[model samples]
Target: MNKQKLLIILAFFSIYFVWGSTYLFNKIAVSELPPLFLAAIRFSMAGILILVIAKLLKKSIKITRQQFLNSTIAGFLFLVYGNGVFVWALKYVDTGFAALLASTQPLFVLFLLRLIDGKKMQKKSIIGVGLGLLGMYLLVSQKTIATSEGMVLGIFMMLSCVLSWSYGSVFVSKADLPKNFLVSTGYQMFISSVLLIFCSLAFKEDISTIKTISYKVQMAVVFLILFGSIVAFTAFNYLLKVVSPEKVSTSAYVNPVVALFLGWYFLDEKLTNQSIIATFVLLTGVYFITSRKRIAKQKVRPSQKT
Candidate 1:
């Protein structure tokens, strides 16, 4: 209803749809481009675009040495480990299973937060997390991810990516980065770009001719850079600061529904009744986590009740 709440809601939509759709775009981009290099270039371009916007707005881009270090750490954690590995894993797994595996991110986040800081959660949230995990398993269990080699390795790698992303998401909250969130995000993306490019070169990933890549693929890459990196990612960072990390992690739950539907509609991937049921259950968990029931504060005289 209010502007702040409205903005938060809009932010949720940005990450929910924008980042969710990126799985489809990523499939397109990596079909031609080298996965690590593709991610490196995408984030690098997005980082520069964000910096330019920040400069145009006259936002302070200055930061302390510690902030820069923090950005570098987050950069490696989120982008290099989380996203780069994820893109590579996609080659070995189908879209349905990939999104479902990645959706375990919130569970990892919950465990990490509790393990690191002993942050206790309400029973409702724990229940939500449990139901989400079970629902995702049921959704993707029937899907075929075994058509490729290294299926077990792919599963481990995807789960590792989830942990990397979850930890990075939580760490940023305490990383003492720049006050200007955009500036901080720019630094992180830039730092990750450097690391990723280094890895790409180390692996000698061959880059094909731009002319060989289709126009649709190129546009998908551009969409990933602009919307996924700049808009949705910035919104995610904002959400982390304002909301609980567990709550922010609900993107994992919502993302699969979008990714699954888009995969079915565009790529002719299977859409099963089991998957539909999973979506409903996943969304219900997200609802439980994100929705806050307002409780009226009761004012009572001292003599009324103990």
Candidate 2:
């Protein structure tokens, strides 16, 4: 295979395996750390690391005013609300359940596109939506979840996170950004880190409590910053420009499987029969939604401050 092909394969592996495992790691870290503050630290450190790497590689860190504004918006949508808040909700929801809920992202993307751009859905897309909704209902309506404090709210917030992430995906495909993909990713992460710290403060999270993070949770945060934030996330953004967004979104199917398995094995989280069935249904729906034949490739402008 060519070098590009190898890079693509490696990138796909990063998003598939590394991103999938993040749910488990996030669950581990948030068990002790304040979620928003944890996210702030992770992103801030990762962002700085990426910029340093960019400097070593002689990549430009300069961005236009519009690019900066766009990066901030993308940061808010994708990181602050999509990821940081979602991690906060993890305190109330289990890792596997959160991952399963995230499986509905393609459904949200289709719906959002229809709403924003009046994009017509294909027949399979409609069926996918129906199955996605059914799976979500099954997953969320479990007696265990219903009785758990804050579980319902966590589910709702997770769904909102999916919506925000989907919209960010659509937006980034078209937005002008820094020419260097790594630089753009760094800007977004850095900007979102600032936003998340304010959010942590607004929610009255004790910033000084970082001092209290257990060694185990601290390690988990390190894993998240290194593998999840830097490797998997950069791979995701790179894939978005190289392939179709629909293709990149397929990571949703793989993530939950890894999460469910790791959560069950490592954390002793339960996997109910209903949850299993819901996973099957949700992934099947995702398959259908993304199963359309390949068409003309519209590269995502090779920049993703969007």
Candidate 3:
């Protein structure tokens, strides 16, 4: 195969396996570290690493003023509220279940397109929205989950994170960003890291805890920074440019399955029958929504899962 073809295959593996594994990594990391602090560190370190790599490659890190503001907004939505808050929710929710909930992003994107862009939802998309809602209700309304302490709040906050990510997806499409995709990603991570630091302090998270963090949590964070944030994300952007978005969006289907399996196998998180059924229903809806020809035609980057 040509080098380009080989890279595409490797990129697909990175996104499919690496992005999926991030949920498990985040779940492991959050067991000891404060969620906001953990995310701030991950993003800050990953952002710096990315910028350094970009500079070594002679890519420009400069952006227009409007681009800077847009990057900050995107950073807040995608990284701070979207990812940071989602990690906080993971403290209560199971890693697998959280991945299932996040699978609804395409559904959220479909709704946002209709509401904000005044675009009409096609028949497939409408049916997708219906199934998506049903799947969500079934997933969260389980008796066991509802009875757990703080789970209700966790579920609510996780949904809010999905909304934040959905809105960020829409915002990014219209926003003026750095010409280089890697640079834009770096800025988003860097800017969001700053915001997350403030969030950690505002919540009075003990910063000193990092001094005693376990080897496991430290390794998880390192994996998240290198594989999740940098490698998988670069793969995602690369795939977006080379492959059809429809093909790239297939990660949505694979990621949750990978997360669910890893959580079950490694973390021993239970997988109930309802969750299994909900996964099927929810992913089917996501398929219906994203399979629309017009949506597939647009270069809509589905935000990172973890």
Candidate 4:
């Protein structure tokens, strides 16, 4: 295989495994740590580590003010609202359910892009969006809809997380990002981490709670910081430069499968036949939506008659 193919494979493996495991890790970590506080520390540490390495390599850290402003918005949307609500929702929902809801982000992005950018949605993409939503409905309806106010609120919060992530993705594709993807991402993380810390403090999270958590939870947090944030994100950015954005975006589809499996195997979460059917429908939808544009672009032109 060529170098580009190898990088794509690496990217797939990174996102597939790392992100699949993050749901479980987030569930485990939040059991002991405050969700926002834990996220704050994880991203803050990762950002500092990236900056240190960039400085050592003499990489450019200077970005235009516009780029910095854009990064801040991306970070707030992607990290503060996206990841923050994700962690918060874990307190009320199972890992599998959270992953399932989060997987809807790509579908949301497709519709949002069509509306905001005036990109025409192909029939295939529309079909995909429909199937994905149907799958979500089936998945959620299988469970006795939680009647408790807290559970209802948690579900809405998770949906908000998905919307935030979807909006952030659209902005990332259109924003005036720095020339260096890594540097841009590093700055975003740094800013988001700071904001998360303040948010955590305002919510009155007790840092002392960390000491009471099991060692397994601590290890989970470490894994999230090292693999999920640092390694997986690095691979994602690398793949964006080499592959079509659509291809890289397929990770959204693949990740939920991994999360479901991990949740079942390690956490002993039950997956009903309905869940299996939903996965099939959702995957089929994602494949169609993501590939439709490429298929459209490849149509042969009509010959001119003389």
lDDT of each candidate versus the true structure: 0.74, 0.82, 0.90, 0.77
Per-candidate clashes come to 0, 0, 0, 0
Can you write out model 4's per-residue Cα lDDT over 1-306, one digit (the tens) per residue? 998788778877987778778999998898889999888888898888887777787889899999999999988888888888678888887677777777777677777777887878778888988998898778777645455446667778888878878778777767887767668778988999999989999999997897788999989988988888888888876776676667666776778888889889998887889878988887778777767765333211100000
Which number leads on lDDT? 3
Report the Cα lDDT for candidate 3: 0.90
Worst 10 residues of 2 by lDDT: 297-306
TM-score of each: 0.82, 0.91, 0.97, 0.90
**Candidate rank order under lDDT:** 3, 2, 4, 1
Question: Could you tell me how far off, in angstroms, the CA of residue 185 lies in candidate 2 after the best superposition?
Answer: 0.8
Model 2 lDDT per residue over 32-122, tens place: 8888998899999999999999999999899999999999998888889998889988888888888888778777877877898787888
- Runs in model 4 lying further than 4 Å from the true structure: 1-8, 147-149, 294-306
On the 0 to 100 scale, the lDDT of residue 19 in model 1 is 79
Which of candidates 1 and 3 is the stronger one according to TM-score?
A: 3
lDDT of 3 by residue, 25-136 (tens): 9999988899999999999999999999999999999889999999999999999999999999999999888888888998888878888989888898888889889999
Clashes (candidate 1): 0
Kindly report the root-mean-square deviation of model 1 from the true structure over all alpha carbons.
8.1
Candidate 1 local lDDT, 193-250, one digit each (tens)? 9999999989988865455889998999889988888888778867876876555656
Ranking by TM-score: 3, 2, 4, 1
